[model samples]
Target: MIVRNCNRCGAAITFVRTKKGKAMPCDAQAMPYRVAPGGPVNIMKPDGELVRGYWLESGTGDGVGYRPHWASCRTP
Candidate 1:
């Protein structure tokens, strides 16, 4: 599993490799990542290399605004 922070929301998104070798978001509450047929979505990394994976955008459909970022969790 690979964990990456959302660019818009900074949420820690967990990605799992499928049996077919495709990366998929594992969080149930996360917005569905659109998978383009025939190829993976291209995301530009900080180092200028291109990466293929599911990307999530920030902001709600309603007028209300949501801050993008994963909520920090505490383990008991």
Candidate 2:
């Protein structure tokens, strides 16, 4: 992951390249998440895999993952 700051909100982030070779800016911190396909949220795994789910900030989860920076960008 290549670390950088969000251009809109200036939050720390890292780029995760998708299988299609698209680079996505994701939050630097990793959070636990549960698998919920067709859910309302999307998370990027450390290996660049994208999954649909919700953040598990304080409980058990399917795995740990990162959220796209745009989700929390303040200036967007």
Output candidate 2 Cα RMSD. Answer: 1.6
Candidate 1, run of 10 with poorest lDDT = 61-70
**Global lDDT of each model?**
0.39, 0.86
TM-score each candidate: 0.29, 0.86
In the range 1-76, model 2's lDDT, one tens digit per residue, is 5678888788999888887789888999889899898978999987789999889768768888889888888884
User: For this target, which candidate reaches the highest lDDT against the unseen true structure?
Assistant: 2
Tens-place lDDT digits, model 1, residues 1-76: 3566655555566654444565554332434233333434443232223344555575432222111222322222
Candidate 2 lowest-lDDT run of ten: 1-10
